[model samples]
Target: MHLLEGVAAILVSVCIYAWAYGKHHGPGAPGWAKGQLFASLISVLLVALFPVGAGFVALGLTEAMTPASWAGLVALAVLPVAIWKAVPRLARRA
Candidate 1:
């Protein structure tokens, strides 16, 4: 059950991150979105794997992260603006 929950959390987090990335980057989003999703997924997975990390994440959530997560959630909430800002710079160098 614990393993299942961990897997579910990883899946959910990846999906959320990918959805945010896609919304920001649009249908034509670059590989960087995937990279960010992967990075987020790895971070969560690492937390799940390490009991200490999991405790810290839980504590952080209870204290600092609740607010920070809201900010991140808001940032993700406005992904289109981020995409608009990022795509041009990405295009310029390429």
Candidate 2:
């Protein structure tokens, strides 16, 4: 049960981050995109680092997570963005 919940939280955080990242990053984007990108990065990082406690703070039925779990969450959280930056896009000339 705990593992499943932790996975879910990480997934949700990454998905939300991806949505915000896609919205802010692209061709012909607005000038404020950098700010948006920064905010989105911070947003995901916080959620990933404090998955359970974040929810428990409001609901008050959860316990805090350990440091190792936080590291794992960080890895999961950054994987998508890392791949995005590392992989090449289609139909593009460099």
Candidate 3:
């Protein structure tokens, strides 16, 4: 169960981070990118901190799930992919 929770949490976190990365750094993102990013961060934090929060509740059922730790793992999983996808486009603009 612990392992499943960890995996689910990681997957969810990665998806959220990827969405945020695309929204902020992708081409033609809105002018309010900072606001959107802030909101996303807050949402992630809430999930990590509140067990009853949607993210927490979803991840809690899986194995090896701990709110803060899983969040970090998810970030680790997503950041590289997001950067890989975004950096090339950004460079072309440069």
lDDT of each: 0.48, 0.51, 0.54
Tell me the deviation in Å of residue 25 in model 2: 0.9
TM-score for all predictions? 0.31, 0.37, 0.41
Residues 1-94, model 2: lDDT tens digits: 3433454455555555555455456665456755856776768676655567345332322435566456545655665675466333421222
Of models 1 and 2, which has the larger TM-score?
2
The candidate scoring highest on TM-score is 3
RMSD of 2: 8.8
- As a whole number from 0 to 100, the lDDT of residue 80 in candidate 3 is 63
lDDT of 1 by residue, 35-63 (tens): 76765765675555555433433544455
Ordering by lDDT: 3, 2, 1
Q: Mind giving the per-residue lDDT tens digits that candidate 3 earns over 1-94? A: 3333444455445455556566666577667765866777757664774343335435544446567556655654665686577555543421
Better of 2 and 3 by lDDT: 3
